[model samples]
Target: MDSQKRLARTAGMYYLIVAVLGAFAHIVRAQVYVPGDAAASADNVVAKASLVNHSFVADLVQATFLVFVVMTLYRLLHHAGKNVARAMVIFVVIAVAIICLNMIHQLGALLVATDPAYAAAFGVQGSEALVLLLLDLQHFGYLVAQIFFGLWLFPLGLLAIRSGMFPRLLARLLMVASAGYLLDVLLQFLTPELADAVNPVLVTLFSVAEGSMLFYLLIRGVRTLRPAEQAVLAA
Candidate 1:
């Protein structure tokens, strides 16, 4: 019971983290980022839309994001055992892979931005080829990460819902949240034109998924603690 409470507390902390990060991103987007883009050139637009500065905010937020993902999946992989930690380490591996991919793409974009020869060739006049390239990489990278996060959470949501470890409603909420994320991503892919428009509804619904799950964790987490069951499975 105590263990469950502790986990719930941690889950609450994660909610705070996500909420704070999202809020701060919104503030910056409103004041500085969007205004700067309006004045930027069309050629520079793609690069600006590449999400260079936006990516940095996301980078900071995601630094510890994987930790929560790993924590939630740990119980599932080990079923609660001494090896739970081992299972969680797989997430760490995923994080490293993502970081590596981002680094490589960022570097490639950098080369594009700085190489005046390449810039001239592409007819990229306003935005540095390197800057736009990097932004492009960052934008795509963000989308990829979102896909992974949604899919990753899907199973976790199912697990909690099916385990009968918490209230049925909690599970339902998770399922709904998962669906929202999936839908949001699919919508983004369908509308290539709106990809950079930053529509308010899209952003709003996209975040509901996270908020729903966080609510469940903070509220019903006490009922979901299954360390003994987890230990048996881990064995």
Candidate 2:
């Protein structure tokens, strides 16, 4: 139980780091990216180059720490169901890989916006257009990664429920949040207009679910298992 508490706290700390950095990166992107306005987007990127760079670095760091978050979680939760825990880890790993690769598009956008060579080669308007295209690709790539992000939560929620460590309500909320993420991605790709309309609701759902889990882990950790529960887990 002591060890479990330690693991839970560690996972919470790592998750907090990932969440904060990820939010910062997203906020920066939202602030700088102007949809359908390539010239304006390029100008924003150039004007906020330092912030953009910092956001890029934040993303990389978030991705790196996400692995730590999941590995610790796997350790803490694997006793519930090894296969489920493994699935969760695999999903996070895939998401991390996709995120790292997606950053190349971000880097390309930055380079195109700031590098004089790109203007010389493609002209200013062309360079700006290329920047927009790369940013668009980066946006889509993030959605691709989000698919796995949502998937991992299913296994995690199941494990939490089975383990009897977390509140069942919280576990269910995580599963619902997982579905919400998938729905958000689908709507964004399939019916973008509707996606924009409901995005706030989806974001709120995610915040409530993930925030609850994080705070619980940080503040409450896992419940101590009874002897029978321990035996069952051993079995």
Q: Which candidate leads in lDDT?
A: 2
**Model 2 local distance difference test score:** 0.94
TM-score of each: 0.60, 0.97
- Tens-digit lDDT track of model 2 for 47-127: 999999999999999999999999999999997889999999999999999999999998999999999999999999999
- Report lDDT per candidate: 0.52, 0.94
| Per-residue lDDT of model 1, residues 116-181, tens digit only | 666677666543534544545655564565555555555555555544455656556555655665
Q: List RMSD in Å for every model shown.
A: 6.4, 1.1
Best by TM-score: 2
Q: Count the backbone clashes (under 3 Å) in each candidate.
A: 5, 0
